[model samples]
Target: MNLSEHYNALFKKSSELILSGNYTIDSKINDESDRRFGITLLVRPNEEIKANIQAFLKELKKTEPHQYYYPNSDIHITIMSLISCYQGFSLDKFSMSEYVDIIEKSLVDVNEIQIDFQGVTLSPSAIMLQGFPTDNSLNVLRDKLRENFKSSSLPQSIDSRYIITAAHSTIMRFQKKLENPEKLIEVIEKFRNHNFGKFTAEKIELVFNDWYQREKNTVNMCDLYLR
Candidate 1:
């Protein structure tokens, strides 16, 4: 299937799971005391897109009041997970300058990625902003990162969990049993075609972050600006 078809299937699957009561609940991913750190590169949607998302979220909050909603500060499009999270991970053990150099070099000639944020999609445990990149610039950037990182001396667990091929961003994750899945599904269906506008990403952040990418738990290591 094509990229659009693949994500459409994902949305349909999640919707079916919700209606049939077969979805997974949240895991201990939000555990405050558990320490797991990973490095991730991501892009943030501009203010116009954020405003559109906030408007939709205002409506969704009334439907699922107890679930975790991502704050405006944390909304981002992940470019790559340079390293997957693991317990007791620390930046002190690695060469931060090396990572910065490699990232800056990898970004060379990578054009700005234009994205259209529209609709909602979900996995069994979370709701996401369905992002569609207009071209293959996103893929090129990702491949360059992997290629450069692999050629370097640094150890990385990039895509060990899975390779990222889509452009969606998680907006909400279930932390408790869905009190009323039908009502939540109603909200999903209502704004499933939301147009959050389009913007070209001018920068990407490389961060050392917690599993959740919560702003309080994240530290920005460097930023790579695009053309």
Candidate 2:
């Protein structure tokens, strides 16, 4: 099928998945000490691109004001979760700093990556703007980091189900079962092939949790600039 047809089919399947309650909605734990550190490409969309996305969200809010929209500061494409400082697992600040150093050293030869945002899709948790990189730079970067983390003595955050094959930036999330799910689908259908613009990911960040909060935002512990 074509692009529009493909996304339409995905929308239908994802909507059904949401209704089926088969997936879990990601949430942050209450305690500050329980938050996890994640490696990610924090996207800073240009003014034109940001304005375009904000405009769409403005229109969507008219019909679904209860939906949780991601603020500009919170937008990012997660690469991999590094370590958690929760429960009996203790990752001290010094250790986290060491991991950040390792990440920086590992990605020294990587170049800036070009990414294009297009279309929109629904997931069990949120509405997302799909991201496509211009080349295999992102995949190569992820694999390099993965190998580095695997060989390190650090306590790696292991979630067997977590994988990042494709990138998507979250737009908004459902607060409750939508009163009219079709309306949201209609909006997505309109932008199924919309070009939301492009940006270069020049830096990768080691972001601390609180990145997921609406009221608050992510704190970048450190960043590694691409060559």
Candidate 3:
């Protein structure tokens, strides 16, 4: 199915769980010993879209302030997870120049992409801004990244979890047990069709980061521009 269809399906399933008070709660949120790191290539949403989502977050906070919401700085649409987070990783082990060269070649003539963030959706763990690339540019770019990374001898475990095709940007993750999920669900339903804004990405950033992508735990690595 297409991105829109997939987003709708996910919304339907997740919202049903919310209505039935069956949404998942993250217990590890308070665990300080949790240590995992990853390398991801992602696109930051435009300021207008970020402002729009932050406004929506204000509404959600009134209903459920206990849940963790991603700060505006961390809001992004992941293009690819080059290396999913692992238990032990040495950042110095990988050559920065090699990855840069490979990715630069991969984006040789890729088309520019426009992601329209049109609504709010959710999974048991998180609330997301529904994103849809206006054309096949996103698919083409992802395919190129997978193909190029596979050909390179440098270490990369791209798509080991699953082949990513969605453009959705996760905005919030459950940090605690819901006090009244029905109330939160009502807030979610209120913005079910809200228009966040559009993000026509010009560049994608590759970063070494902790699982949460916290600014303090992240190091900027490379900038890849779209055509």
Regions of model 2 farther than 4 Å from truth: 1-10, 18-41, 84-94, 211-217
lDDT over C-alpha atoms for residue 75 of model 2: 68
Between the candidate structures 1 and 2, which one is better when assessed by lDDT? 1
Q: Write the per-residue lDDT of candidate 2 for residues 34-79, one digit (tens) a residue.
A: 4433334344556666777888788778767777787776666766
Model 2 error, position 40 (Å): 5.0
- Residues 121-151, model 3: lDDT tens digits: 8998889999888888778878888899898
Model 3 regions more than 4 Å off = none
RMSD of 1: 1.4
lDDT per residue for candidate 1 within 1-227, as digits (tens), equals 26668778988999899889888877675676779898898999998888888887888789878888888899998899988989999988767888889888887868788989878888998999888999888888889889999998898988899989889988888888888899998898888887888989888888999888889989998877786
Q: By TM-score, how accurate is candidate 1?
A: 0.95
Candidate 1 vs candidate 3, lDDT winner: 1
- lDDT winner: 1
Worst 10 residues of 2 by lDDT: 84-93
Candidate 1 Cα misplacement greater than 4 A, ranges: none
lDDT of 2 at 153: 81
